[model samples]
Target: MEVLEAIWGLLAVALLAFGLYCCYVKYVHLKYDYIPGAPRASFFFGHLPYFWRKLKNKEVAHDLFIQWAEEHGPILRINYLHKISVVILSPEGVKEYLMLPQYPKDPDIYSMFFNIFGVRFFGNGLISDPNHERWRKQRRIMDPAFSRTYLSGLMGIFNEKAEELMKVLEEKADGETEVDVMSLLRRVTLDIIAKVAFGLELNTLHDYQTPFPRAVDLIAEGMTKIRIPFFQYIPWNRKKVKEIQDSLRLLRRTGEECFERRRKAMLNDEETPLDILTQILKSEAQEGGCDYDSMLDNFVTFFFAGHETTANLLSFTIMELGRQPEIVAKLQAEVDEFVGVRRDINYEDLGSLQYLSQVLKESLRLYPPAPGTVRWTGTENVIEGVKIPANTALNFNTYVMGRMERFFKDPLIFNPDRFGKDQPKPYYCYFPFALGPRSCIGQIFAQMEAKVIMAKLLQRFEFQLVPPQRFKVLESGTLRPFDPVVCRLNLRNPLGF
Candidate 1:
């Protein structure tokens, strides 16, 4: 009887505290009432339900943001519970915020990313770290890995993996069979990152039974659940939660084994292959070393970050090229002229494919793999004459800003010509790899890898988009083609080889 009474008393106190916190949240949120935004459907849930509904229906969240941008002007405030996040969809705002390091990534948003299903995902990794100084330290240590000399050495591996993919497609390029280009691209990119970054032979391209690829896919798919409040407690999500946890365990386990092997090699004074993992280990040793878990954090980071964005870009570019044959012909001509019948693509050949470069830039303008980045405003700020509250979530997206009519003429049209040599460069408006000090360290590396794979594909094949397939975007870790970029391929000018 006494224990029961005590439990009841504690429950009463907890309920009362929760009620007060809710009241405080509501009061604080009202402070941003002046910011222009869509009418709230409910004070408690805000737009989260709407966002979730869109995701549930296999739709992109950025489309809704674009709609609100059109309706409520470029700057809008969206609320979830008591939190108010500001969305900036203008070039001026993007320049003011993204072009400077004054803004750091939103801790609240990044905190959500630090764990998936209670397992640490990108904990303190370069992408999920909110601390500016710490992130800078990591970035400085990892810079040498992405240098031109290091990446140039990776050309052989890039060509080898791409050739494996081409051979796979060659088997299916009989024109009667439909191939899911995006899946094959994902496998090839996954294979490249594994081999180049960690010196692991993932063999995802050739091996259909790899558990790592399926685990990664599950992890990406399961990441969306992070947005739901107290998702783990929900009965329906128990199976999903367990699956995500299992996937995370597999990745972390593999990461630990890889780290141990590298450490053992260094300890034995063995010949360590110069790769990203070696660079990280060298940095760790020189810097008096970080914990093993810290190394694991980066190992997982490099695997996901180094692979998905490049694959998405390549796949999206392929889909667009299929839709526009004339543009494809132009790209093919550039590749043919520069690359000729060479099966081996060198770093020098990457620069001369100017038309292909424009096509890539144009594709990124439309479908930025990561969509956008969010910044946490710790103090009140002003942008474009509008007052912004402190402690607000600020979202700036290339996808939104790149599509605005004010920034790009005929924004809806996919025109690679807009990126012609004579055309003015998009300074602030175009940030596919983001901008400022927090910009992606692997930008050059990703683009170079993309160019190699794309050059080879264009040189070898003529692909037609399979009809009845929706070319929409999937909001996974990166935005991928919703229908997997299904295509029917035929060898183009077989004698050219």
Candidate 2:
């Protein structure tokens, strides 16, 4: 009771003193030198309470970001508990701040990735890691996998998946009923990705009930693990991370098994049938570059990045088409003129459809898969007009950038004419695949996938909105439309196809 009480009293006094000091620093000193951003801290927790990260509505997210931008003058700070990050809003600011050598492209959200995948797999990937030289080398290694002419060679895979999707829709609407276009698009995207990335051709669209498809489904569930943020510090929530890690390991093991089988088949036959994965293997073999682990890393990266964006973009496009009948009708006519009621749309005919391209560009502007991109200052650099010292984290919300009034004439309105031939070039203003030296390599693949799926869907059936047009946001690590987007797909040559 003697020494223990004295120690306890001293500890309490020290804690109280420290807490008071923290309050003074946050509320007083931080206001002057810490850079302006969020409101002054209300003592202990700082400004943590202001972060609306749980927000599911993207419009709300957009509005809040705009508010921050206005107040903080483009670059601003917000505390994620003890970690403080600066958010940059303008595209100009991105070029100025994010592109500078001083600001390294820190995959800041990488901490959120947890154990579902490790830094070795996800972090080492082209999108996540930002070392400019390392990325250049990795991009070169992965280049052949998505060569302009080479990817179009896999058009057959998309055609096959598209036809299968049509067949499933036919069965569901045997006598003309409603079906969820979003779910159907997800399945089709998965199947196409399955064939191109792994060369497995699981046909997840036709049979999602089976084991392989179930595993794929589980992978999607694991992706949703991105939302659980507090799991990092609270050991209790680490179980979710462990569960995701297990799922990732399971999928990776599946990829390895597929890689081995594919290699074996190639060894036995020498010239059976080779696609992107085969090409990647051959490319790696010849150059003696990129070890097994690196290739495997890219295998997972492309496999995941390849499908989800295409699926979500198509889903949103279909939803928008349903809302805008005139646009849908026009798009149908374009599909009809190029493709037909009697045949599938081939690669040769894909380019002739100009309107098809416009619709995709417009939809991408509205709901870009990547909500924001982050970079850290590797050395002292200036951005947009602000002088940023080295090691400062600069995060730009590209999703918000796409909808900025400064960048576009009317930010909220959806118009494909924004991308028409005569329209002024929208260069830095619109970048769904990002921009500059670090722009996405798989953009060509993504565009082709979207076109094929949409062309096929428009040919077979017409989409009509089942919802009352009230928007709901799906915030994956990327953003998507939540709630099974129900649409009426009336089978016809609605595009006169």
Candidate 3:
């Protein structure tokens, strides 16, 4: 009888705690009632249930975001439990929040990148660093590596790597074998970044079994998984978490080994190319001491950032070209006119491939790899006649903005002419590389590398999309096609070979 009474007492306490928690969730939900948003699926879960359902159905979260923006107007709020994020879709809001003031990056979102599955990754690196002054210092130190003179010299490396891809594609360009072009594009970009940034020959294009490539894929998967609340704690996720942890370890270890090799080379006065690695080492010397962890932070940051997005850009470009024959013809005509069977495409050739440039810009408008950036606001602000409270996370998404009817005519249509020379550029609405002081520093370098690879591909092959292909976008940290973008290729100039 005494034991039963004790059990009842414990159960009463548990029920009381549950009741208070539900009341708190209800209070917070009512607090942001003024902001327009889809009705919460649950008082406790907020919008997460709807968001997860869409993700589970293989639909990207941004698609749902776009729908909400259309239904509720430009500025809308979303709740992930107690965390309220105000997604700004209006150009005015974007300009005010992103460009006018240097709002700090939302620590809640960026801190997730500092460590994944208990492994250090991108810890206070340039991309993940939230402190404005420190990020500026890091950015200043790394600017020279991406300067015009440095990049102009890199054209040779870019062309060489692109040619390597061409040769690899030639082997499978039999007009029958369905090649996963996205995979090949990723490998070539990986090779290019390894060679150009670190002076290391990854040769991923030829060897498909490289650990580095697999590590990147695993890390991306881990980044996505970390966003799901309590994912790492679940029993079923143990294996997935371990894989992610192991991948992070491999990446950091590789960065450490590379840094040591470079340091030794510098100490021995061996001739080192004026590459990104050399610049990184130089930055350390200028800072007056060795911070190996900081150096490794940048090493891992650049290794992945330098390649992944550009590869996705190329992949999407090819996917669109395969679907639209007229666009391919226009691109081919421009490539042939400017390049004219030239084995080496010079800097001047890149300038004259204007149509190719337009196509790439169009692709970015529709499919930006790094979709959006998040910022934190400390003071209450009014945007688009909507009141956004202080301590709110602001979301600025190019993917959502680019699809809005107000921003583009027939937004779903893939039209390169929208970016033509005579066309008026979209006002503050199109920022694939982001806008303002913290915009991507590597934008020019990425575009140049993409242009070279794309020009060469158009000049060599005629590719057709394999049927039954779903052109679905995958949001694995960065946006990429869910499908592998398989295509059947035919050599354009068979006789020239």
> In model 3, what lDDT does residue 80 have?
75
- TM-score: which candidate is best? 3
lDDT for each residue of candidate 1 in 289-312, tens digit (9 for 90 to 100)? 675665677777778778889989
Q: Which scores better on lDDT, 1 or 3? A: 3
Q: Order the candidates by lDDT, highest first — what do you get?
A: 3, 1, 2
Error of 1 at 70 (Å): 2.4
Which stretches of candidate 2 lie above 4 Å from their native place? Answer: 1-48, 53-62, 97-103, 117-123, 174-176, 216-243, 266-269, 494-497
lDDT of each: 0.85, 0.69, 0.86
Candidate 3 per-residue lDDT over residues 1-497, each given as its tens digit: 99999999999999998998878877877778899998888766788888789788878889888889889988887887666888899889888888854698888889989999889999988788888877777777777777767788878888999999999889999999999999988888888888888888888888867788888888888888888889999999999899889988988898888878888999999998767778767876786644467667877887788889999999988887878998899889999899989878998788999999999999999999999999999988888899988888999999998988989999989999999989998977999998887788788889899999998888999999998777779878899988888999999998866
True-structure RMSD, every candidate: 2.5, 3.6, 2.1
TM-score of 2: 0.87
State in Å the error of residue 186, model 3: 1.1
Residue-by-residue lDDT tens digits, candidate 2, 257-374: 8778878878787664557778766676676666566556666676677777888888778767767888988888998788877456677777888998999999998878766667
- The CA root-mean-square deviation of candidate 2, after full C-alpha superposition on the true structure, stands at 3.6
Model 3: per-residue Cα lDDT at residue 75: 86
Ten-residue stretch with the least lDDT total in model 2: 112-121
